[model samples]
Target: MVGLMSGILLAPSAATAQVSDGGTVRQLDQLSQCRAMTDDKERLACFDRASAAILASRAAGDLMVLDRKAVIARKQSRFGLAVPTSEMFGGGRADEVTDVRQLDSTIKTASAAKAYGRWNLELANGSVWQTVDALTFGPSKGDAITLKEAPLGGYRATIAGGRSILVKRIR
Candidate 1:
């Protein structure tokens, strides 16, 4: 550990990982440095000191090592697909909603229109949107539909160049 840490400290080459302090790995290259000392007594003392330092650092809450699996799972749970770095990466936590807009989904299965009555539409993403008011016009399978937040509350469903109705997402 000393030798590895020494080389990192000695060599200024950039490392891929950054610590919480915004500093890259900088430390002794390996324990060989202490071994290289000529006196056996001094070498033993040096090794003891390094061991104690490692333990002290651990006790001081100065180290955190995240395994690859933890990072992979964090990234997966955060980003939906492809994991675009521009929007989801870097030092920022992307938990903010940047816009209020329509939630679009493909109509997978739709209940038969009740002729001047409310109807039902099941989206591909498993959201069931049913009309709350009269639905004179209805959607068909494979139609791209959008549900936008209504002014007061609830949602309004509409298809491209089609009629819109007050719809609510049940599931």
Candidate 2:
């Protein structure tokens, strides 16, 4: 019973166990290191130092903390932009998380460009999409539109139950 008690006392706690798992964030890693310290005073000191470092990083714009919802919202907002793809913006395991495939919105405005009868359409979500293909029927203000990822390349915009036209985000 005495040996059992000794073994239990020496065993790593849950907090300390997590410290061994590698973390990608430096400020978070610093805080995790505090859990591994055995000495009470040393652990407390480490925590204080880590907290200060986190504050400094945040103020310097070197570190940011975002909830999953905020990250997903950001990804949706940037859907048709020319931004590079990454795990940071919904690029991950397909089974776990799928990328944004389409955006449904109302047309804020639509105008014909000077060249080739192509149309420039502004959506309610503040995304400006320009048609790559010449339009037979142009979209109008307040018309519901759906912008989807084209299987080949670029994007396709379906305007108010009309046919899909190849489009690209201009803004």
Candidate 3:
């Protein structure tokens, strides 16, 4: 009876130790791949691949999978491929509007002024903002904002209460 009780107590600990070793190996492999990558694009891709692999290898009840997923998600965002969620809008209601004016007709000067409190606008990368004081000419639906010179792509805008906007660049 004493031997059986000791075995039961030790079994879980051994399994846990095995899992820890596996996780460490996986993480080391991922780090090696990241170090081997040459460019920003390739590095991000590597992170994505490694993260997926690690997540798949995680045990059913392990919470570490969530951390791995988050790391990959952040890497994807650095590549400008992330899709913004509603929660990114800073806890405000989002609306779609139309008819933005271009500073120039070449489409390079186009600007979308998102009216989040007092006319606040956001750029496609969700990294920039434009604020207007008068609310006198704001962004409308189907309007595109120029994030950089020349057309990279279009962005979807989530305007919130004229205070904050979340823009996800559509690549």
Tell me each candidate's TM-score.
0.43, 0.62, 0.22
For 5-29, candidate 3 gives per-residue lDDT tens digits of 1101112332354334433344435
Q: What's the lDDT for candidate 1?
A: 0.54
lDDT of 2 at 121: 90
State in Å the error of residue 143, model 1: 1.3
How many steric overlaps are in each model, in order?
Answer: 17, 0, 12
Q: lDDT per prediction?
A: 0.54, 0.70, 0.37
Screening candidate 2 with a backbone cut-off below 3 angstroms (N, C-alpha, C), the clashing residue pairs are none
Error of 3 at 59 (Å): 2.1
Q: List model 2 lDDT by residue over 1-171, tens digit each.
A: 112211001112333332333434455667888989999999999999988876666565555445455555666788888884435432335213535778899999999987777989988888888999998777789999988899998899888888888999999
Error of 1 at 69 (Å): 18
Error of 3 at 163 (Å): 18
Candidate closer to the true structure by TM-score (higher is better), 2 or 3: 2
The number of the candidate with the highest lDDT is 2
Candidate 3 local Cα displacement, residue 148, angstroms: 10
